[model samples]
Target: MSTNKDTMPTALLLGATGAVGKALLKDVLQNGKYAQVVTIGRREATVDEGIPQDKLVQKVVDFENLNAHREAFRGVNDVFCCLGTTRADAGSAENFKRIDQGYVLESAKIIAEENPAPEGEQLSPVHFLYCSSANANKNALFLYPQSKGETEEGIRQTGFQRVSIFRPGFLEIETARSKPRWAEGLALSIFPPVNRFFNLHMSVPVTDVAKAMLTVAQKKENAAKGEEETTLTGSKAAVFSAKIIDELAARPLTQSSDEVLVVRNPYPEPRSFKVKTTAPKQYCVRPNAGRIEPNSKVEVHVILQPFKEEPPADFKCKDKFLVQTAIIKPEYESLSISEMWARVESEEKESIRQQKIKCVFQVPPEQIHHETKSEQSTLDNNNVVVNDVLSETPTATPVPVPLSPVPQRQQQQPAKQDLNDQLVRELNHAQDKITQLQKQLLVKNEQLERDENGFRARSQANGPSRKLPPTVQPQDAVHHHLAALETQRVTEGYPPQVVLIVAALVFVVTYLFF
Candidate 1:
């Protein structure tokens, strides 16, 4: 349910500094529906995480003694409570409850008793959004689950009639900031892929969890005002349902697909009618150049499937692929889930490489992000900050723009707010790479210098004017980089170069036989 434009639901997000809470915050902010957001925690949050300061109501409070700030909960509606304390984090069992159970219950009491709205302006009934663990049963003896179960029960008892609970099975992802244990993340990733076979455990992505939370928050705020949403939807496989699971367990693989002699066509009299194997054909991705970096987006047009008598449902292809950061660089590459942009192309039709499609994906350097911040800060130093309508813009532009024209900042901003923090890290990494490459190259160059010093020294001193690698002797560096780039273009998606490389090896062996 979409909230009314003028009066979006105002939310009080407790446990606002947690992994799940931070995730929920990003999605909520991205959704852009909430009218106001107040994030509170045991302490004031810092810029240690790249979260911009403007968004949060950072507070450091003793949840054990929240009496001083009890009035703060006055008009808050849609309370998202992710507050918790691990045994280790709290130091003792009693300490843990004070944060997880005591802290939460106290907050609930304030929300229920402290109805803080101005005269004649009624506040929305608070909907408590909670995060819980699986197997959180009231009868459980384990301390963690027991306390969690108690918190869930406590919220139910609170007068805030509407309650929403999210008991994610196992949070299946990691943060860019921390090094989560490998085994936990591995189990989450590997188990979900074969859900039909594995019935015991399932996991949902953090994105999906955040999405569900936002969905229910919207429903409670905008739907039948007092409606309580108990509908659970995540990680339930079609085969896991008793009836469906039983049916699948009793059946054989033969039920899935049928093989028929797809009619030897009637129109031909050309002796032999060899049909192409309908095994979903082949796919390929050809990037225009070596690396798609920032400021430049590659144009990638899609190739249409053949008009041959309408293909079966299994054969139909759709353009669906995600841009993945290369293991080395975060530059985006287009990937089709069906395999590649060429999945439904001519190769599958017994036609040789005739389909070409084009679509554009943008790549910009990290500097662009760098210079914009400088521009904004420049406005401050130059007093570009304004008043009236739209406010003041900083008069001075700190970073210089080139006359020939290129994006201002050409750097990728580390999720951290300060540009200085990431510059050292990325620059250090770049320097390490440069040193390693140059070290090895130096040994080779030294031997050559012993043969001829003047020419090699001149090349090194001139820097970019150095001669090209012998393998690419004829082509200029720009053309060489472009050629090297093209050969590996869709390497992120398809197998054109790989197949050629493999074929080349085979051909070499065959020639030796001859």
Candidate 2:
């Protein structure tokens, strides 16, 4: 098979001597998609007879000292790690951990550290495919599963761009091994009939496991390059169960048109999101809606339904996708994705944010030159047609159309309505108090005038013989009482403007109504 050198990917495989690793080696070597396959182990791997070894590179390196052999991981786009051992076979729990967890994690670290981008440039994260056991939990009581779970976690921490952890239940090894596992053999013999009758996925063929890893890796690489959609989901670090692995292996290797769209929430608050594609009949999106926490992201898988006939080379994708997102309130956070979206639609429709992305289909590189020549010919024909049209209308010229700017979502008005309402209430209360104060002042003025009139009459009748006691002016006493009331109202937390307005109102009433 002739492979395109420029488009082919390189793979770095670990544990090539193991059963699953051997099958993986055979698949990658014959797949025609990988340009190079590098296998690193404690000793050189033995290739089967009649299998080509031109693209295969084997490195004998000490797993404990992977730093010394960093070159083996350089320039590799994907890594397949099938390294693991049972505690009984490894002789002790510590040995099992050392081999399964320590070595596997170290290898991942070396791959990440060795494959650095050149200065001032960036590179996509390497896709890592791991073969982990089923029911692996970091808090597992058994050492085997515990080590496997802990190792999976360690690999995640190693910063590989994309990670796929395959958890096969009971692998049916076709090739004979140096040490036979009686329990595994018995389970393998029993699971097929049991699974066939009960519709369970408790076992998988070794070749299928290898095939599943290759399929995922291929899908991931193609999805990155916009050639195919991603088959995996959940997180950047995805886990595949036995059933999923079987399903993935059953998928054909060619003519897949899957794409992965990523939705990220940069806002500090959590967000609810929904995805919809234009061609719902032709395409299906996984996790059409969900909630994303602050500073997190979710991947939406777009799967294209199979076509009956291939489109021509000039096929352009007319499909589009819309991503709808909204900031989630604490109450809506607890709601299901559908319920949350429904609530948002009914309650806060304007808060929903939407982004539309156009779909782009990439043609094969071999057709690029032909497609370019065809495009040039079309452009020439269009220019000739345009010249003819312009000659017919000598004085007319095409006017450039100005595109309207996209309207931005208006900012929510500041939440000062309540505050303004409270201010209005206070102002009304202050005005009523001022009216009451005005009435009291008028009554006092009337009493003071009466007393003054009486004093004047008495003084006149007594012929200036009666000594006037220390006389108090009614106006001065009224002014002092009003000033004291103003000070008291000011001290009671009324704003200066309110106090001033009250005083001005009282003075106006005293001048007019009095």
Best by TM-score: 2
TM-score of each: 0.41, 0.45
Candidate 2, residues 323-428, lDDT tens digits: the string is: 5666668887567888888888898765454434455443333454445432110000000001011000000111122323222211212334667888999999
Q: lDDT of each structure?
A: 0.47, 0.62
Error of 2 at 159 (Å): 1.4
User: What is the Cα-based TM-score of model 2?
Assistant: 0.45
List ranges where model 1 is wrong by over 4 Å: 1-6, 44-56, 116-124, 176-186, 189-201, 221-227, 231-233, 236-514
Total clashing pairs for each candidate: 40, 3
List model 1 lDDT by residue over 223-281, tens digit each: 34323333222343210000000010001111231111111111111111111112223
Residue 95 C-alpha lDDT in model 2: 89
Candidate 1 root-mean-square deviation in Å: 31.9
